[model samples]
Target: ALIAAFEARIRAQPVHVAAEVQLAATAAALPPLSAPVDEEAEAPAEEAIAPRAPQEQVRVRADLLDNLVNHAGEVAIYRARLEQQLGAFRAAMAELDRTNARLRDQLRRLDLETEAQIVARYQREQDSADPTFDPLELDRFSTLQQLSRALNESAADLTGLQGVLDDLARQYDVLLQQQSRVSSDLQDGLMSARMVPFDSVVPRLRRVVRQAGHDTGKQVQLRLDGTHGELDRNVLDRMVAPIEHMLRNSVAHGLETPAERVAAGKSEEGTITIALRHEGSEIVLQVSDDGRGLDRDAIRRRAEQRGLLKPGAVLTDTELDSLIFEAGFSTSEQVSQLAGRGVGMDVVRNEVRQLGGTVEIHSVVGRGVTFTLRLPQTLAVTQAVFVQIGETTYAVPVASVSGIGRISRERFESGTGGYRYAGEEYALHDLGLLVGQGPAKAEGQAQVPLLLVRAGDLRAAVAIDQVVGNREIVVKPVGMQIASVPGIYGATITGDGRVVVILDVAPLVRRHLAQRPAAEAEAQQQRHVPLVMVVDDSLTMRKVTGRVLERHNFEVVTARDGIEALEKLEERVPDLMLLDIEMPRMDGYELATAMRADARFRGVPIVMITSRTGEKHRQRAFEIGVQRYLGKPYQELDLMRNVYDLLGIARARD
Candidate 1:
């Protein structure tokens, strides 16, 4: 009826005739409202309406997942602490058992002695000719017998208690093992949840390469391998920018124009390959291009023009290549859309460093250039080696440590400030000094502990006071204020609840290489001077003694106390030590004793001068191997004579 009414209205107004005719055709094509339904269709509809399966996956907020991972890490840390406590308890139990055995043996000996005394008393009574004397009296109870019986019963009770404790300890150990397994699984599951395949970023990278190629008017093909490899989502997110920069850099600077490529007997299309894989605990990413390689002469000339290098400064190819990462350094003749302005490479290096990673560049003259980035697999938790630099503990990522050993004084070249490791000579840096904690002192031994660390192609041996073993630590950012500090990666809380700084090995190695030449030059210039150390709590005394040594042409290093002296001694062993008897932290006699105990300082001559002039004081000083003991208000001539004699040097002409 409605269609008929519309058709009549359209016919009255012919201008709407076409719309009315189309509407009538659409209505005629529709099925009638009274059409019948099939019973079979109803049955199939019921089957299709059955309940759907629940979703197997759910989306979770990123911050919520990170919190769960952090909680899991906390569980792991507490588990470690529990393990340490269990070990200590086990040791204490063993010691208690040993003590019980000793007490039982002593009690047995006492019983035997009591029996012998009774026998002797019985003999004495018989020898006295007493008619009432009886052997049964010898068995009569006494205070000693009662006390012994009571002690025996008490020992038996203790033994039973020990057995119960042993059983309880075993049960605790089993429970601890269960907790450890559960904690490990939880941490693993959370970490896995945060991981993403490398291919997740591949599309974005390809887009970047495509755009860069279009901008540069070059034909470039990007090849990606190991797309299935996975990394923590956070690490991958931060890496995307650097990877993009490197791709753009390859497109603009690494690849050549199509005509130039053809002139060089190469294909018109250039290829850039990016490969990702896991190397131990590190994720290794390589970005390579098949184009004209880095020009060493061009880099050198640019560096010279920027005053970064002297005109005739000698540098190896490797050293020359490193200058490209210097901030605002470039070889381009003029600014352009991409290549100039000198910004990308340095930013790339800093980004990688902040991620606790190292960047290495390898280039051949005519082949190509490859940039390798070795980064931690995850920033959440990592295995680290704990070391004692001075009084503080530090954590070094285990991936950076190649080896650990001890080096004797003879093996360390003081003039060169380096040691040999794995057949390669590497500069030796004191971990304490590197961290601004002063030089690390050897623990009364000539053989100091050394850690061989590597960052890309650079390696160095770091001297530390002691190795505190390894641990699984949760990495925490040190916040923005300290984020730019070199050699410090982050911070972590140890199992013992102490916060320790995580050391970034790449910057340390770079710093050592950068400063080595100057340090070597200084060492050479001061090699002939005899260094004398003056340790005293008195400001006047330190100055007076230092002045005297300096006047005599001796290189003087002063310390407020023995502790400071020990720190300075690690830098350079002094020829002689002038010590004050009374001082804070460590006194002169204690210092002398420690020096005598250390192999490196055992032969160093020590002169003790103090107001304590008692004979016992003098004897104690001598006993500590002090070569001379002079009282306060000592004659300058006498002191000079003793110093000259101990050092085996000629006296100055008067």
Candidate 2:
């Protein structure tokens, strides 16, 4: 057993030259007791065990210390450049301040000049009326008129100066825009320089996977896909332990033993696939295993044993899957090195949350289990959806924003009720009202800007005045005075010098729910509404279509892109489809073609709504079997008319 264990360890790790030489020497020095071994003609054991350098040693051309030094130098250079730019920006601001002061001085002089001219005119009229007026008084009035004329000339010059100043301000704004772009690029480049491939941690993860497989007496194969995908070095460093724990969980709990897998009609050797892919601005890392999958029954029973579930309370599959992340929660019967401690998963959840990432689990019993970790490329900067509520600007992490759309008040069955989004019912909160800025919507306003936010299992819509746009923002913590605010997560400075609040999603939703208990009941009643799937990447477009559909009494499900649309389709096919011509990943033509190929979706009516109005584009869409082609900025009535025609429903005229 000792010899076998030693051999296994040697096979697992690359042998060093010194160790190989020592092992050979020790083996050669041993006495040969068998006649067959003595008769064998061979070179000395030391020579036979040729000392070859490990593959990793051969592959490493430069020392890691040298690489670190080089990267540090690059970072220092970027810092210097950033500092210089900031100094320039300050100088420009000072110049602008001086120009403003001069403009103010010019305006005051002009005002005084006008008043003096009026007084001189009145004096002249009085002097003309008086026949006995002194020459000195007449001369004084004439001097005052001359002074006013000079002041008028100065005012004209000031007006030209004002034009120049206005031009300068416009130029300054342009400069600022350029500077913003440059700074963003510089920051991105600096971040990219710090990005390391997902492969960086794969070797270590591979070892852990192997060891866990051995300990559990299961044959497991680890395969990595898209290992070249880059992630921030700091984020990757923090991810090492959590990823290892997840892989261990896959091998220990997710994958069954050889016998069990075979009995379940699966291959004798289980496979654990770790795939890394870039999804828009985020990186998606999926750890999946093919084994006897998550046992929902066992998880429920364990939850009951631990008193996590109340008596006679039933939990959905989604809720049951989430229970595994609870602190001190485990389904394993016996404690082991890999799991059953119930400490790892909760730690994983906490770390992910700290990094502004999300971890989701999808399991199909007897098929497999998949754990997906969606993380931003870097935590220092995050893409956020900027919105306006009353006069305040707030930003929400893009990951939390499921969709954006306009919600018309006229669409609600009552004055205020719940709405359905993405085939799920969620309470809608008026952001302006919640923040005490004003009413949710201004009186007599036709539509409200709505943002769909999903945090964990909770989904809700927030009403804002408008969505300024989406951009990458560096978040800073609010001071202690307002840090305790329930829904305020840090704050960030916008390019135009506005300090925008970043919302803490989960808490904000909780606060909204607490304030309006009636919304919960309304949400329960929204399940029976007709669902419409709105697929478009633009936030404005999503809201526009959603609002139009809602106005006609249809609930809407929205997707940012065609890929997400397909995922939503897997969950629930909508009563009607509204697709855009151009989108990321998959466009309308491609989506339509793909859907037409699938028997399940062949009969679904697709209305191609897009800005691409070229005849060729329309012809191509028609060829792809789109039922309708609506041009950009279609009127509400026209859009509804087309939708009703396709869905065979009549729209009531106001």
- In each prediction, how many residue pairs overlap at the backbone (N, C-alpha, C within less than 3 A)? 0, 2
TM-score for each predicted model, relative to the true structure: 0.69, 0.57
Q: What is the lDDT of residue 461 in candidate 1?
A: 85
Task: Give the whole-model CA lDDT for all candidates, comma-separated.
Answer: 0.83, 0.75
What is the Å distance of residue 242 in model 1 from its true position? 0.4
**Which runs of model 1 end up more than 4 angstroms from their true locations?**
1-55, 126-139, 390-392, 413-425, 436-447, 466-468, 479-485, 506-654
The TM-score obtained by model 1 is 0.69
Q: What is the clash count of model 1?
A: 0
lDDT of 2 by residue, 1-654 (tens): 434444555667655645755675676676654535532455566556886666662233324533543444344344445545565666555545544555566566865776666666656677456668633355554555566567657666766766676677667667666765675576656566667788778789989999998898999999988888888876798889999998999988888888888888888999999899988778888999987678888888888889988766887888888888889998888998988888899899777766667788888888889988878776666789988864578888887778887677775324477667778766777676566555454322467777887766667777776788997676565788887777676777654555788876666666665766554444445333457889986766887788878777787889867888888888667778999977768988888898999997888899888988999999988888998998987887788888888887756766
Best by lDDT: 1
Question: Candidate 2 versus the native: TM-score?
Answer: 0.57
